[model samples]
Target: MVSSISLSIDSDLDKVSLLARAVRALCEDLLGPDDQDAVELSLVEAINNVIKHGYHGERGKDVQVAVGLQADQVVIEVIDHAPPMPAQVLDKAPEDTFAFDEADLADIPEGGMGLALIRMNMDEVEYHSGDSENRLRMVKRIAPRSQ
Candidate 1:
C-alpha cells in the first residue's frame, strides 16, 4: 500500500525549509525508526534546488511537493514551472565525483551539488519536464540496516 500527500507553495528558499520539515514528519511516521537524517537532508537539497535553480529566485511561482510512502520505500516529487535543465548537464557526473577538493568547488558552479547529493543518497532519481512543468522524482528504499 502507498500513502501520498501533496503541497503547493511559493517558490522561496525560506519557505522550502518548511516543506522539508513537513516531509520529514511524514517520513518519520511512515518509515518509523528506519528513516535517517541523510534522507531528510536529501529532501531538503532537492527542495532547495527547486526554489533556487528551478524558479530562478522568482518568488510568486508555484512549487509543488509530493511524498508517497510504500511498504518498502519512500518517494518524493518536486515540481516547478522553470525551464528544464539541459539533459547534458544532468547526465554529466559532478567533478566532485572524481575528486572533491576545494579546487573543485572553486571551478564548479554553486548549487550544482543539490542533484549530486540527491543521487548519492536516493536509490533512484528521475527528471521529467514539459512546456508547463519540470519534475524531479526521487526514491529511497527502506533498508534492513536502517530498521
Candidate 2:
C-alpha cells in the first residue's frame, strides 16, 4: 500500500495532536499495531521538539509535518523555520538502549531525551537544516507478513 499526507500549521502545542492523527491515518494499512505506536511516539516527539526548541514556544511560527507510506516502509518529514541544529547532534544516533545507573540516576538530565526516543522508535531518522528551513525525516520499515 502507498499513500501520503501533509499538514502545515503554526507552532502551537495544541495542534500537535492533529498532526498525530494525520500520521496515524496515513499508516492505517501500512504499519502494524506495534509499528503504528512507534510512529506516533516518534512523530509526536518531533512535533513537540519543533514547538519547543524550534519555535521556542512562540506559537506563531510555521511548521509542517508530512507522512508517506511505501510498500515496505513509512516515511515522515517535518519542516520548520527554526535555525538548524548542530551537525554533531543531528548526526549522532541515540544510544542502543536507555537504562539508568542507580548511582548516577540523580545526575540524569531533565529534557534531552526526545531525539533518543525518536531514533530508538524509528528504523531511520535524518535531518537537514539550511536555506531558511529545517527538515527532519524518519522512516519505519514494515514487518513482513506471516506465511
| lDDT (0 to 1) per candidate | 0.78, 0.83
Please write out the lDDT profile of model 1 over residues 56-95, one tens digit for every residue: 7879989888888888899888888887888875986755
Clashing pairs in 1: none
Worst-scoring 10-residue span by lDDT in model 1:
29-38
Best by TM-score: 2
Model 2 gets an lDDT of 0.83
For candidate 2, write residues 1-147 as lDDT tens digits.
677777898888898888787788778777888889999999889989988877789988888887787888899999998978767666554662345564797766566578889988999988887798988999999898888
lDDT of 2 at 21: 79
Q: Tell how far residue 83 is off in model 2, in angstroms.
A: 0.9
